[model samples]
Target chain A: MIKSLVSITGVALVCAALLAGVRYQTAPHIRANREAATWAVAFQLAGGPFPTNNVTLPLANLRIGGTRLDTVSTPGYGGSIEMLVALDRGSIGGVKVTRHEETPGLGDFIEGEWMNQFEQMQPMEVDTISGATITSLAIKRALQSHLRTALAETAPEGPPG
Target chain B: MTFRQAAIERNPAWVQLLGLCPLLAVSNSVVNALGLAFASTFVMAGSALIISLLRTLIPHDVRLPCFMMVIATFTTCAVMLLEAYTFDLYLSIALFVQIIVTNCMILGRLEAFAARQPPRAALADALGTSCGFAIALLVLGSVREIIGAGSLGAGLDSLFGPDAADWGIDFTDEGGGMLVALLPPGAFILAGLLLGLGRGIHEQRQARAHLRETEG
Candidate 1:
């Protein structure tokens, strides 16, 4: 009985030490990778004659050229869909699905040609993609709500128009 | 058994039917398949080594539980390392990653072979088994990805890095890839075909060997 207890404890302790060592080495790289991905997604939505030294705006928004880029998430058929919506002069410049959990073949069209409809239009004009109604609706609803909040927050700046 | 025999004649995936859940689920893409394969191999070999080292120290009554603890520890290490270094791939296979702890192949080997073998022999067996499993995953993943997307290596960038972004091949000029091949049923069909192929080859080899023996 005593030997069994001692052996179990020794093995558990060794395993814990090994895990701690690896966690220490990997934590920083993971953080940096996530940050880089977020930045890349934000810039890609902005669709620019590239901006030099794009300034960080308020409310998790980015200012690139004349466009303001922000990210939002909405519940979809499978899970949450995260999108980066770029606003140029109070109209939708472009919208990009940064991440999603819709059905891989059926509903993932939100990341494809279906999203092209949101380009250079008002958020209200966005339509649901055929056969992917739930995912498309999620993106549209999320974009409307986010646009409302963005507009309300920046109303004092004479609206991007 | 020799490594070649272990990998082919007694393959854990094809012949023994072990660890098929992740094999089918993540085999949609080569990168996902490779990621899971690497993790499984690491856990299998590490657990084999640790279990062999403690074979004598573990009491008979609690041996199974002890073996489980060792396998779980190695799996946790694999999970953390993947999450930290290959965050995208980790996210894609997170569900399958946790499932690896319960993969019968690891426990099966520990009970059937690792418990009785020396550390070196056990490690070699684990390596061979893992190689077999990896090969099966790669073959299934390639077939599925190519047919499903009309492309190969679509997500290599996630596994290798930015330099691999252009590695994907575009087979169709105007793309409308088959959607069914990316779904669950596709995995089932492809896996069954591969298993049948393995069995056919094995049977043919046996028949030829028997003929040679009878003539001799």
Candidate 2:
């Protein structure tokens, strides 16, 4: 039994040693990867391809210059999915799903080309992703807040378009 | 210990039912399920081998903790390897890969098999447990993926590299695929169906065996 204690302890020591050694080595790479992915997504969302310069989405660096959060939702297979879109300097700077209990695969309409549809569609136009009617409508309804905010910023006579 | 006994009797997911967390979570997609299954297999096998080899001297009092420590180590290594090499899968799987450390299957096998049996027996037990888990994951994954994504094993490039992009046969290629099945709710519904199906199969097999017994 004593021998067992010593043996197990030895294994513990080795594991701890490896953990101590490798965590530091991997952290930097993980951080970089996360940074790159975030920027790539943001760039794509900002109506541009990822830059070759490898710059991050400079949320902190860029002044807010004025921003508004608009709530949007569409019917999802699971339920209603509400999303919040951030308008910075009159452009769609950030978008996040606020309330979503969507079906795993079927309701993933928020991602991929489905989400991209929001870029071109008018807030009142209401674009739906074919089969994902509920999901797409939820997104459209959710965008009502953003539309309100847009209308508020631009008076009836002024063309923010 | 034959493979059959290990499967139906031991039944890692249902009978012993360890690792059900990941099984329940990732079983939404066959590819995700398979990725997890293979990684779990590697970790289980490695941990079992190491624990069994050192079982003789491990103090009874600390056996559980020591076993956990060993298993955690192998799981960590595999998790790191996956994240580093398989970035897309790593992205998709996210935290579930690390959560394998908490999987009762590996720990249960360690305590039950490695603590009591020889290294080879422990290995066999681990292999059996992994196989059963794999089978469960694959079935659930296939159902979910086929229903949700309209394709089985469609997103191969994310894991096996860009070359495997063509590996997945797309039903949507002809402009047809049920988009709803690809969401989270679809995963739950599909998994529930499979579980029910498994129960049905088990009941039929039992009824058949009972009939055979009567005839004999």
Candidate 3:
């Protein structure tokens, strides 16, 4: 019994060691690739017209990052919706209707291009999502609260909008 | 557990009730949940396969540390694959993807199923768990993607290839789309409704099965 156990344990160790080595070997490349992609998105979110390969700028004000807008819940035409606003500095960055729980065939465009109208629009210019009025109000109110909070808070030096 | 047993009978969500945070947090859309489910399954299966295969050699004194080392390695690989091939998905998932290393389901299956069973059985358990997980994720994704985006699998272009643009459906005419479904809070409520929906289906199936039994 002890011998069988030892053999099983030995096999386990050898297999794991081999797999671990493969993982470690490729770790650095994966890390670099992911970082590069994030930097690109940050610039895009910041409304940078040119691709600034430079990622981090600790010394500069208006660095780039995705600002998660105030999330709120409401009965949409489909179900529920989550509105995330990407902000650069105090200016509106970009708006992504991150998720929509509305009905698929009837009212799914809450996250589509039509919502782009609100991308850089001011807090007061909040528009309603057609076929999803309750969802629209909930989102607008949450965004207003976010804009209010952002105005109240000291702006972080992220990418300029 | 057997694949059938773990997947349907003793499901991690409906039955075992493990890993609910990541489950609920990531299950907002099919894309999000699918990304996470694949990552989680990879880690669980890879580690279990490695560990069970090596069950003969490791010293008992350092087994836990060894197990961790094995688990971490696979988790790192899962993250790397996402970063490489699915960079957008990787960014959307962000930290939650990394947190898979700490998910008890991986470790739990390692200890309970993998350690006690052979590599094949362990693989089966991992497959079962992931299948169960994928079902949950796909359900969530279908609900959120279809309802939130007004289409199913929108933005699958990036996932598929350049040619996929022709495949997506356009549902909006003007003043289209809801915002709440796309953001964070949507994740929470969307998942809740999906879970409720899953339960409702299960109950209906059970009721139908009972009716069939009575008639027979």
lDDT of 2 by residue, B146-200 (tens): 7666787878888888898888766666643565565667656766676677778
lDDT of 2 by residue, A1-161 (tens): 76766777698887788677667677777666655665555444445543446433334222223554444456666876655465655555567653466665676757655554555656557556677776666666656555655757565776556
Best by DockQ: 1
Instruction: Quote model 1's TM-score.
Output: 0.73
Model 2, position A22: C-alpha lDDT score = 64
Worst 10 residues of 3 chain A by lDDT: A55-64
- Model 1, residue B191: what's the lDDT? 95
TM-score for model 3? 0.58
What DockQ does candidate 2 have relative to the true complex?
Answer: 0.26
- Candidate 1 achieves a global lDDT of 0.81
lDDT score for residue A92 of model 3: 63
Q: Would you give me the overall lDDT of model 2?
A: 0.71
Q: Rate the local accuracy (lDDT) of all candidates.
A: 0.81, 0.71, 0.67
Off by over 4 Å in 3: A1-161, B58-64, B165-167, B174-178, B182-190, B200-216
TM-score of every candidate:
0.73, 0.65, 0.58
Residue A12 C-alpha lDDT in model 3:
57
Tell me each candidate's i-RMS in Å: 1.6, 2.6, 4.9
Instruction: Report residue B205 deviation for candidate 2 (angstroms).
Output: 3.4
Q: Which residue window of length 10 is worst by lDDT in model 2 chain B?
A: B173-182
Per-candidate count of clashing residue pairs (backbone under 3 Å) = 0, 30, 48
Query: Candidate 2: which docking quality band?
Result: acceptable
